[model samples]
Target: MHTTKRLTGAPGIYLLAANALVSTSAYALNTGTDLNLSMKPIAGGMAGAAYTNPQEVSAALFGNPATLTRFKSLHFELGAGLLEPNVDNTQTNDGYSHTSTSAARNYVVPDVAVSGEVLPGFVLAGGIGVDSGIGADYRTSPVNAGAGLGLGGAGAGGAATLPLVLELLSFSGNLGGAWEVTPDLSLGAALTVGFGLGQLGTTGSTTGLQGLSGNFGGTTSSVHNISLRGALGATYKVAPEWTLSTSIKSPLQYDYHSILSTTVNGYEQWQSVKVAQPLEVTWGVATDIVPNLLLEVDVAWKNWSSAALYQDIFQDQFLTMLGGQYTLDAWQFRAGYSYASSLLLNSPNGSLGGLDGVGTLPLNTAVPGVLARNDLTKVVQTTLAPVVWQNTLTVGLGYAFTQHFRLDGFGAYAFSENTSRSTLALGNYQVTASEWAIGAGANFSF
Candidate 1:
């Protein structure tokens, strides 16, 4: 028996290890009381509510200005934590193993904010803090030549491989104020700004293949922009032991100019893309059920129907065949059950999806020339899939060792399962992929 020998050039593989990093880097939602700590107030998963206590009230400045009136002295919150991510995947079809390690223990994030008593009934507060701007980091080497997979050769002549990697980082900060009207009502607002960075690159060649063999190409880019945002908060002592508090943070409209640069065959190319992030709204209520014990829940919505964060391109096909663009949209609902132990525990998660009628290229021509398109209906219609919807549950505990020092621990479970099936062109073959992730973090305040 004789086996045929295939000759091929190296293929480029695009492995993204940091697809979504926002939820993994931010605070876990719980009750209006917990919000006063280093993380965002209002428990569960939104950033637009105020705090329950005076110390935590300063932390609320990031969401509402009127919260400042609750503070009397100049106070500050300084802290940081480590993020550990665990990702896993199981593939079918001509599946391949393209897994990645973790970037845990990378850096200690910090929070800094100060509030002062300006006059009898007025107060001012402003500070800089770090919040998870995206989700976790991941790397999976797709097995399709169309994916530019650089591992082993599976071509006409041999196999082709394209080695690609992606890394990401993000952060944000805000400054604002609050005023007291009657002794029971307060009104306030603030301005928020943020920045993000990402790196993507590829290199390698197909070996012993037919008509395809070459060096690699690499590219990396970053984005820095400013957007304006504001909020309003109010509290009413409905009863002697019961207080009703509510707040709203205006959604932000951002115009970001991303700086992109690439190098192919030792030549460099540069370009810029402008994109938008939708406005988000959050509302919730907190009550002291008993002494030192509290309960709260909040809901949030993100208008992701704005724009595509990245563009898609397929060589060898007519540009006219491309379909309309798509964006992301979601809603987060959170409820908290807590115990004011030497530690605090809060769990929050929600469901979100993309809009309807969007289209995606499910199958490309391995034979070349035939184009197949599907309604992103799978991704748009299903709560999960073709498009990606992520749900997260968080558990946090806080312990105060002494009067001036305290510590908080957070463990989070975030799952993102995409349900659409599609293929791209590489050496006339189809390519497909799916993913899932988990993460944890901690903080100390003085």
Candidate 2:
């Protein structure tokens, strides 16, 4: 039996701080252009594409609501997972190489849902979960300080030295119903309300600059508002052993606002900004090749072209992001193996850029043109933190201890990928990232 412990006082603060260390980035599961993380261990173990099989109650709320029709008894489920991602960044300028790694090590995600037949042919379900999100926390480094503040080689000391933190959370509530039109056909729809919060913070010390000195800090300028969206899905039993399904999710848009604070000549100042989300669609099929043996596949497309994440980070913002379509999952002995493709866009050199007017300052008369140019380059490179594509593989297992109780667990590993950006001043900027996840959940039915 597993035991649970409650955290209090300093321990709770440490836990919260540990969670906060994870920064927000596109490399996260279902983050950036490809925003789809499996909410259940079975599906997550199957490469985040398990829409055709109605195996868990929570699947109905997150995947295909129509799958709820497959359940004959009332069902309840609750679970949580941890994701560990390691990101490394390296930049070489004038033959000097600087390397840094993300301080974030673990992310905790949880989910809960309940579903049942409300009538002869209809099923109703509701749930709450963390769908997809990203975060990053980098330790203090000379390179980060130099890049963040455009203070390249200014004082013997680098830019204000401190840790950088960024995080984005997407929490959602879902309500939906599924109807079995006939013995072999089902249709489902759901209304999803999402609440997203984005936070960014930076703190550091400054040198003998007369105007700008002391500590620097910032936070979200405004609280995020709840956003509404919808999803539609359909499943067809083509044969006694074959099932096909498809789902489309509307875009979720949130107006993000943030404030950057700093003291200039004994006076404080602040600035603000906004961002938007994207749309997505998924198609899948599952088949029983042999008795008690199943195979599943899924293809998903994300409309990142319309999202602000890519546009703000890359110059080639017109490219629509396409996710792995060849994801394959095979199940036997209540165990499953999965493979998923990458969801990143490969743009040409110089295709990526940074936000405008971020970290800009009046020219320092004391610095020479050469020094000023170098500093500006570092500033732009820092502002436009780079993101790349990655592929993943997963394994999962499900076990039944009794007629009414079941447990499921899974683990996934994302391959490492490196991407580079070339600019007139910064030369080449590169970032590499790799990730993995583990999750478990329990389901009850009677």
Candidate 3:
């Protein structure tokens, strides 16, 4: 009821028809292949691991609240990014290979924020952006995947087809401020309202909903939800050339109304579900590696093993990021690298919870020979939403033309990675993913 009340107008309508998918494979695990693309709200040369040292206005606003005090005067930054993610899916069974490439590319990521001194000892900040997104499309595949989902080749012959189509995006808007606590230490916090929207469809196929025995696989569902979360951070200057900072972000949960369901005797039934993002803790440090060079490194941990939907097949994640900035008379150069451990640290082996309105049955103890009908569902899910990317490389540039204006640009590439899983239910499933993102922006400081 509360979610419906807030999402009733144009925003809801656009979310329903919005096809400009951002990036990733699943709701909880789609943190993107690069920092600027999904993990952070930054643009161009500012696209590095920055928390201890604020790279730009938007970075401090959304990254580390305590870092906001780094801005002595009014500073404004407006930037956007064009991202292209390439994903491929392949499933082989009984001498047939069904492969399709993701048609969802060219996503627009925005970064708009400002920070300024509202008082003599305190500073204020605000920003909004698309945090993370991921999706896949198999509708255009000529393979006519009809193996396990019913029709074409279900039980009549060779395995089944899984032309699943899915898209999910997480967005946020925030407002907060920081204080100059002493001369060397700063403390601040930020509160944000998070929004999650997504659609899962099998491209005209009826999926197994547990207890629905015949002609299954032709079902689709969409969910839109909102929740609250906040972050607390502190930054301290260790010396004239080094700074240290850390931030702790609370977990955000999105309650989906009727996101899953079953059917009975020609009628469809539905139930609610909740998928939550994990709590995150990060530590960063910046120091002058040389006279004109500044280096920053950030390390973080994500508690995915304790989250809702993520806990099923995901483990706690550990991530690391590194960046460098070089200053010349009127020009600056930047380079960054970021890596995140696989979210699928513990892969699911035909394990899933209960389908709403249906009884829960463990695959290891199900009526002896039925072979657990849910296995097909597990295969469908794994093939549809797999998280596999791990390494990202980036390079950036910055130029200051005057004391009040500056320009920045950057380019990044995510190396391709592949994985193959074998299960009796779906034979063999494979996924490969990589990405490219680039953008430019300008900043004004007064």
Candidate 4:
């Protein structure tokens, strides 16, 4: 993502394969690791709805810090988002087909939050953002550690290979307080400080890969870190126009370092991985029904088999979001929809059940990575972290211009997701993905 001559043995350990075994995994829009769902861009124009609809001050200090006591004074917001994903990975063996796209697409996510009235009804919050990153970009694809790895790198007298990179970038900072206990209940808490970066496997000379498929004889990989987490919330207002919410988050472990430096059967070995992020519970419902129409709904679970080194390919999942907003006076309009469900505990048709089959190739037996019952780690997790898009659609808008100032924007789309995997040790592997995004932000109050 290794060293090679048919890699040396057991499928030469898929030389530089499974790029960093999820070195920091995630390319989601709400499926795997959220890459900035909210932090305001006007809740990406409703699809993220900032929990109970709190748009400034760091999206309520991270979407639900008890709705930041409904903020009464001093506020500040700044945001920018521009994401792109149009991944296409095709690996055909018998007929030999190769295609690659995903130069990790373009990305930029930023946000700032500031709250005030630190004592009256109690509302203190802080913020920082740049939530997640790391999207695959098969470096021109043209390097085949052979025994049929068939990756590509269509070149033009240059960039011949030695780049394969799986990426991820994470950053966080919260700190919170919120309170209100009565006017209709409210409570909040926060304290997160995540920071993870990545660059899994391969470089100018091909390093290591196949985290569980074996042979990460890497020479040394990278996955830097700093994690610590927390989040708790509640909000009521039960009626008068409804509003009900809840939150809980506390899981984001990462212990990776020098993650690969392999050569294995030929010696050069080195490995490291820890990864975890689960235990997130959320529930929400908001309604305004008609004055200017506002609606929201959220549901999340994500327990992923208890979290640890990426919960063996994930299982306990559930996520759904639907949002709507419409105002008029100062102009506002938004829409949203999101869904997540598949992490396939059992091949949802991608086959790789690996009971004795599909394990051919020089794959020289290792299959240890994300252990979802090892079928060569599901053909190395559908060929390197295929988070398979579930569905997404969003729209956005906002403009205040005064009364304190405001401006928001949003746009999103994720539909096409193709996954076809068959392996008797590499026969058919097709991964197609699609995505789009646009964002904007600005706010100030006093």
Q: Residue 440's C-alpha lDDT in candidate 4?
A: 88
lDDT of 1 by residue, 1-446 (tens): 11112323322322111010111111111100112222432222222223432224335676445657766466555444443333232222234433222222243445566777788777777777654432222223322222223323444221233233333343456777777776767777777675544333232232322322222222224445555556676655556555455555554433323233322232333434433333434444455555554444434343333322311110011000000101112211222222111111011011111111100111111122311122111111111111122344444444445544444334333344433233222222211222222212222233
Model 1, CA-based lDDT: 0.34
For model 4, residues 1-446, the per-residue Cα lDDT tens digits are 22332333354333323331222111111114565354358777666756775656787787678888877698888887877877676655545565655577777888888887778788887888865564565545632222243333322221112344566677788888888878888888988898877555544433323323333222335668889888899989877789888888888776665554443444443445556667788888888868998888887787867776445555787878787888899988888888888764555212121111211122224434412224334434444566778888898999898989888888888788887655443345567777778888888889
Looking at model 4, report the run of 10 residues with the lowest lDDT sum. 22-31
Q: Is candidate 1 or candidate 3 better by lDDT?
A: 3
Task: Name the runs in model 2 displaced over 4 angstroms.
Answer: 1-39, 142-162, 206-223, 259-273, 314-356, 359-389
TM-score of 1: 0.58
Model 1 stretches astray by more than 4 angstroms = 1-58, 89-107, 135-162, 201-216, 241-258, 261-269, 307-409, 415-420, 424-446
Model 1 CA RMSD to the hidden true structure, in angstroms = 13.9
Write down the worst ten-residue block by lDDT for model 1: 314-323
lDDT of 2 at 151: 41
Error of 4 at 249 (Å): 24
